[model samples]
Target chain A: MTNLSAELRQYLIITASYWTFTLTDGALRMLVLLYFHQLGYEPLQIALLFIFYEFFGVVTNLVGGWLGARQA
Target chain B: MNIGLALQVVALGMLMLPSSALTVAWVMAAQGLSGIAKDLNKMSAKSAIKFLVTDNAQGTLFRWVALLTGSKNALKGAGFFLGGTLLVLVGFRTAMVVMAAALAIVWLINLIALQSDLGKSASKPKFRQVFSKSSAINRLSLCRLFLFASRDVWFVIALPVYLAATLGWEFSKVGGFMAIWIIGYGAVQAIAPYLTGLRAGRVPDGRDAMLWALPLAAAPALIAYTLNSQFEAELILVGGLLLFGFLFAINSSLHSYLIVSYADRDGASLDVGFYYMANAMGRLIGTLLSGWLYQVWGLQACLWISALFIVVTAALSISLPRSGSTLPTTQ
Candidate 1:
């Protein structure tokens, strides 16, 4: 495990982390949408619950990556 | 040092907590956080590629980016199915908890192993720098915006509801079809480079995009016409959608490679970030229009509008550089 180059190790970590996050994000969305539908929430209401999801995603891409940048 | 991992872990926990306390506002707020988490993770991961791969290896870059984008999309398909299965097996809150715990472990490994300073530019980029200065990037971003809108405007609201309400197909059938379509689309995207002629050491050029997107513009228009012409509505629409999906996947995968190829080496995330912002805006606009247009004019109208958007996308693709051109000069 320790034999790989540092760069290779970092790459693995990033890909693994991204994949893990994707699984949860996908599962969680389905969980919410289906669960709420079963609980009698209106379709419009279900859609509304995700209103900020895409919006926030755009905002994060534009700002958060910059904000996290260290003075290299 | 990886801000993306933190956001993702927090998002999972938030999902777990919100299920038991199901106020509408709370759920929406959690979704907002999840959205932010997603983009952060996406930006971080993609930008990491630039640092990992050498710049001179354009072929490697294309392959790697295609692999990453393709696999992520395929996983997203799995995630969708997993979401439903978890809900059925463990209920919502428990499902969230289990996912959260699993992601936390992944996050932990990332923290312990990943070296800091990856994807950081040599200088601190001003907040405004998120808006890319590259004319090529700007143009490509515009094309991407419309391309995605063309898909979601019809696919999001018009298609599923139309199939369910109008065609009398079962809900599960509709979902299964869409899921299969998405997974297939992802698979195509992974192999798009080969399909679009990435072999023999040539990368996709603007002309290739133009040639690829040429037929795409006519597809929906033809489908909409066929829908009115009395051919089996389900057959025409479904078959048209499948064709559209394949073409769109190719165009989209090419664009993804182009963006990474065009971005500046230092802090490539800025360019990537700006591009995806346009993408998200397009989706938002398309989603709104999908519902409205379908309501006011019917699904045919939505398809027509989608055709119209693809026309503009095709036009934009033409102005892109010839195969040998290095810069994305505006035509």
Candidate 2:
């Protein structure tokens, strides 16, 4: 790891972080799906739980990129 | 990145509260936080890649983007399996506590490992610039929006519920099947460049995107037709799902590569972010339709909607520039 360039090392770190995030994200989705179904929620009701999640994702991407770009 | 990780921990913590306290609205709120965290981390990670790779190294860029996207998806599949197994083994609240604790540890490590200046750009981009100005980007974003919407329409709420309710599969079976499908999808995505002639020094363009969509659009349609004809529902669905996962992975990988290639090198996050915003919007619409359509009509309706969206995606792909988004760095 020490012999690799700075960029390669940085990429690895980012990838590792992203991997952990994705893992949790996927698991959470399944947990919600099965748990709520077990609780007898309607399909639409289950979908509603994710509405805000997807909605905020739209907002975050639009603004987050600009913030990332402006960072010095 | 740290903020995103911290938010995820908090989201999990919210779920860890006692069952009586876990109201629907509360879970939604927690999910909202997780959503924000996921996109922030994703946008930053993707944009950061532009900084690591030279402008001329587009082949390397494609490989890196595919690997990251593919591996992330594969990990997501593992997460699904973990979620299912944990629920059966320890129950929901316990699983939440375990995940939150684990993610908190990962967060602390990333806090120290990530450099402060990772995605800092030479020029500061303004808020208004967040909306992309490039026609190529705009077209690709449109395709991406519909493409993702098509998948989520069937995959999100409809498929799992259908598998469990109608087919009488166990939670573990449903979750396991979904996990294997996604893991296989990710594997295909990782190898998409090789399948599409990257080995022969051919870099994909808008034409490739269009070509891939044509077959994907047909897959769900065929499934829907077979199911309507009183064929074995379980067999048809499983077969359709495998076909859909394979074709969709290639189309998705191509788009991932194109977006990174087309993004402005100076502040690549701007374009990548806008593109994913459309992607999120697609998921939003598809998720909503998945629930409503499945409740009112059935899984077939969701499959039809998916097919329609893919057709729209193919149409939109036509408007993207036929010329490659970036110069191919021959490996």
Candidate 3:
């Protein structure tokens, strides 16, 4: 019973951490879009910002995968 | 499951969730589902091929592939139209949540349906087994990198910049173009099983089949790039996109073949996650470089670079060895 409770606690902690990360990420994205809009960026410019964001994500994913493979 | 059943489930979920949440949730869920789907589709390819090659197998393979691909295409198109219409009518938040919930439901149903299809087995190598062997690890990593470089990063980063700078398209127009491109792409994939099945009888060998399709599939982009007028550009873009979709479908099928073959030799599921990570990582690099490339050299240069990358990828695809005959067991 105690072990099960510990497992549940661990799961809860992980879930909470994940949610926090997601929320923060989403909020940052929203803020950036809003900021761009305020700067009078056109729709294309806003889209480009997202493209830039995705570009960074691609790099991180690549490096992360490489590291993960190396670790494995 | 039938297309009707899938649509019904999606519609129900759409009704239940808020619009904004539905859109956001659906897109996220779709991305994850796509990842899982890629893995499963690869795993299933061996069986699918076997079904195709074996005589008197009830044509079950063809039917299933057709159904799966068709349903996916129809569902995606429907989902997009539905989501857009919902956003216009109800609001974005509701659409987001509803779409997410709908996708989650579809994924659950798919999970149940696929459970029985995956054969019972302990086929995969242990993590320790894979890690301890240097050659196995190196080969897997290299192949993963190649797969990543071939797809995700290259197109996603280059295409938008290519349009904006070369054509002076507004962002909204680019978005519309992208939406159309994706729909056309998915539609092509949905029909790919039929097309490939027809071609399978003539090719005999896997490698030859993929090699032959590579350039033919890639030619549309170059053709599109040649057009000068805006309307002509849009028409060529759509045509090129359709070709791109066909090329990707073929590439995906071929990649699956390669991955499964590799898995059979090394006996591990580490490749799946590693492969996905590689693709995602490439996207990151491509996206970042694309921005810089645009700022420095403009759109035409980016297109040329993208075209060069595709040609290189096509060349590499020809050299991939055929070895594995079974799916790698997932951990």
Model 2 chain B scores worst on lDDT over the 10 consecutive residues at B263-272
Candidate number with the higher TM-score (1 or 2): 2
Which run of 10 residues does model 2 chain A get worst, by summed lDDT?
A63-72
Write down the C-alpha DockQ for each prediction.
0.48, 0.58, 0.06
**Candidate achieving higher TM-score, 1 or 3:** 1
Q: Ranking under lDDT, best-scoring first?
A: 2, 1, 3
CA lDDT, every model vs. true structure: 0.72, 0.83, 0.43
Q: Candidate 2: lDDT of A4?
A: 45
Stretches of candidate 2 off by over 4 Å are A1-18, A66-72, B43-69, B108-125, B130-136, B201-205, B257-274, B320-331
Q: In candidate 1, how many Å is residue B316 off? A: 3.5
Say which candidate scores most in DockQ.
2
Give each model a TM-score.
0.73, 0.82, 0.49
Q: Across residues B5-31, which tens digit of lDDT does each residue of candidate 3 receive? A: 233334334334432343433433433
Fnat per model, in the order given? 0.61, 0.81, 0.06
Which tens-of-lDDT digit does each residue in A1-72 have in candidate 1?
344366667777777777778877766766676677667665456556777886776676455545444311
Measured as a fraction from 0 to 1, the native contacts recovered by model 3 come to 0.06
- Candidate 1 vs 3: which has more DockQ: 1
What would the per-residue lDDT of candidate 2 be over residues B58-77, giving only the tens digit for each residue?
A: 99988998788768867999
